[model samples]
Target chain A: MIQDIVTVFIKEFKEILQMRGTKRSGWINILVVIGVMGVYMPLMSGREWVTNLLNPISFAWLPFFLVIGVVADSFAGERERHTLETLLASRLPDASILLGKIAAGVVYSLGIGITSLLIGGVVANLGSLEEGFVYYPLDFLGILWALSLLLALLMASLGTLVSLRASSVRQASQTLSLSMLVFWVGIFLVTRFLPEEARVLLSGFFTPERLPMFVAMVVLGLVVADAVLISVAMLRFKRSRLILD
Target chain B: MNDVIVTQSLTRDFKTVRAVDHLTFQVPYGTVFGFLGPNGAGKTTTIRLLLGLLEPTGGTAHVLGFNSQSEGHRIREQTGALLEHPGLYERLSALDNLDFYGRVYHLPAIQRRSRIQELLEHLGLWERRHEPLAGWSRGMKQKVAIARALLHRPKLIFLDEPTAGLDPVAAVELRNDLAQLAEAEKVTVFLTTHNLSEAERLCGLVAIIRAGKLVAFGSPETLRSRRKNERVEIYGQGLEQSLLPWLDTHFGVRQAGLVNGHLELEWPGDRELSSLVRALVERGVGVEEVRRNKASLEEVFLDLVVDGDKEPYTA
Candidate 1:
């Protein structure tokens, strides 16, 4: 099963790398994202970027969004291209295929996030040459990696479920995009319309002294959501149903 | 297993429509078994059922001695399929496409490489294998797909309408390549096609289906010989359309028509041809040449498909 997963992973990554018709274009897209988020943003943020506690927390969302762009194509793209039936006909176990797809999306998303962080570190040092080479605290780096991984897993799980039911890649993309839009709107509504007292209480709860607990709660919430979504997707992934789709 | 595949009253229904209805058949090992049907005749559905991609709504199917419903993966491990579509990743090169399936089947690297080479070279596509399949002609893509199916060298392979969209020359070329490869590999091929000539030329045994029902099953020769109507052609002018109704009403003459200035008649084989010619002469018909002909597989197929519900043809 491990070998099967790796095989599917390699195949999927190869396809993702050529999603733009050429490997060069695919690399360009990834590099562009890394440049904007990794280099430019860190350089503009100045020294506060490394010291600011909120920076890593906010950066975690990048992978969640990045995964959405490609994960929608996992199953839906194969169905649209008339390749799903043949794939289902192969000897590959269902779990391997599902995990491989999710792993591919997670790795791509987290890989970019990690690469950007490392690049951002360099950009931060280059900008702060007068202040001596500085870096993000080790604890913050660990938090960013963990948070990015969890978020990437959450979105990949959700995207795979959407892709499974979608008749085409366009439909899956629209559905995923709509969900993201809804999430953004929900956040905006909560942040902008919350009562003054509630906002105060929320800010107090997220203060540096209590930040670790807050992060732990978020991690716990994501772990539960990821488990539930992955389970549902697995349950829905029977070959008989998929072939009909 | 003596038979690579056996299905007993295998059935599938899509809501109100039955896609495969009570199909029962067995395919012996190492033979090209043709599943012939018109469009929407459930040929694809049956293949799906046999491959275990789609479960049967009723009855059962076993492939390679594994139950399709419970051991589909085991069956898939031992067989290959070229489904209704080529199913190649068009963005990838032909070599990449074959290589992907090789990995899916868990072929060792060295064996995978040699098998891909052997199939591509045999089909004359090795020279152009590095080019992406999206730019290739439909025929070329299909050849690559065939290579992918054969890469793992399974004991059985299912091919659905492989030459449906190809030009006549390409279709014939593909058909010839498929025949040679199937022979050389000694693989059991379950081929589905609407092309009667193709089926006749390649299949050792054939089954005909219509509206999800089995209409006929036998070799091309057996089906042709079993056709109830024996055809006779008489040439040399003066055979009028007016004589068709009389011939149709004759005791042994089933139907008659004037085609290309020749008199065409369908007679029961038990009837004597000499009496018919004498009667034609007496009727002022000039018979320059007379020929008795056996029905072609195409004619047999047409008869069974058109009047398929009459009775099932058994081997």
Candidate 2:
């Protein structure tokens, strides 16, 4: 089973790289993202980037979007190209294919996210020469890494669920984007409409003394969401149902 | 001979419609078995069922000695299929396409490389192996798909309409290649095609289905011989249409007609050819040549389908 998943993972990664017609083009796109997120943004922010917790929080959203872009095409692209049926007819088990796709999306997004943060550190140090060899604090860096990975997994799981029902890659991407938008809007509305006492309680939880607990809660919530989404996606990835679709 | 596939009263239903109704047959190992059917006659459905991609609503199918419903993975592990579509990754190179399937089937590195080379060269696509299939022609893409299916060297293979939309030259080229490859590999081929000529030329056995029901199953010759009428044509200069009425009245003659200055008669059973010739000669008709013609598979297929249409579904 592990070997089968690895086989599918290798194929999916190759496909993601070749999606833009050539491997070179795909690398160029990744480089562009790194340049903007790692070099440009950190260079502009300079000394404040290492000192501010909000800066890392802003960067955590990068993997969410990156994962959405890749995961949207996981199953839907295969169906569009008429390759899904062939893949499903193979000896691969259902769990292996699903897990392999999820792994590919998570790895791609996480790799980009980590690389960007490391390059950001280099750029911040180089741009702020007076503040020689500056870096993100160890604890903050840990939180950033963990949160970004969780967010990437969360988006990938949601995207896979949407891709399962979508007939085309375009439709999957559009549906994922809309659902993400709705999710953020719902969160915003809930926070804004919360009672005064509830708002006070939320603020109290995010205070400096309780900030670690707040972060833990958020990560825990994302993990649960990821698990539920992944389970639903796996259940829907039936060979008999997919062939008819 | 060992049988690679056996289905007993295999049935599948899609909601209100029965896609396959009690389809019972056996495909002997190492033979090209053609499942001939018209459009919407459940050819694709049966292929899916045999591959265990879809389960039968009733009855059972055993492929390569594994129960399709219970041991689908084991069956798929030992069999390959080229479905209704080419199912090739157009963005990937032809070599990559075959290599992917090779890895999926767990071919060793050395064997995978050699097998890809052998199949690609055999299909005459070795030179363009590195080029992406997006730029290749439909025939070329199809060849790559076939190579992918054969990459695993499975004991059985299912091909659904392998040459459905190809030009005459491409179709004939594919048919020839398929015949040669099947023989060389000595693999059982379960091919579904509506092309009767292809079936007659390539298949050792065939089953014709209409409306999700098997109408006829036999060798092409056996099916063609199902019609008991033996047709004989007498090409003569003085063959007149007035003799058609007299010829029709004969007890042995089921039908008679004049075609291209030849008197064509359908004799029901074994009859004396000399007697018919003598009668024609006596009727002031010149007996130039006599030829017996057997019914083509196409005629047999059409007759069976028409007959099937007249009968209502029992269940």
TM-score, candidate number 1: 0.96
State the lDDT of candidate 1 residue by residue for B19-76, as single tens digits: 9999999999999999998889999999888888887899999999999988888999
lDDT of 2 by residue, A84-165 (tens): 9989888889998999999999898889888999888878777668757877888888998888888898988889888888
Residue A127 local lDDT, model 1? 66
TM-score of each: 0.96, 0.94
**Inter-residue clash pairs, candidate 2:** none
Cα shift from native, residue B195, model 2 (Å): 1.2
Best candidate according to TM-score: 1
Q: Residue A37 in model 1: shift from native, Å?
A: 1.8
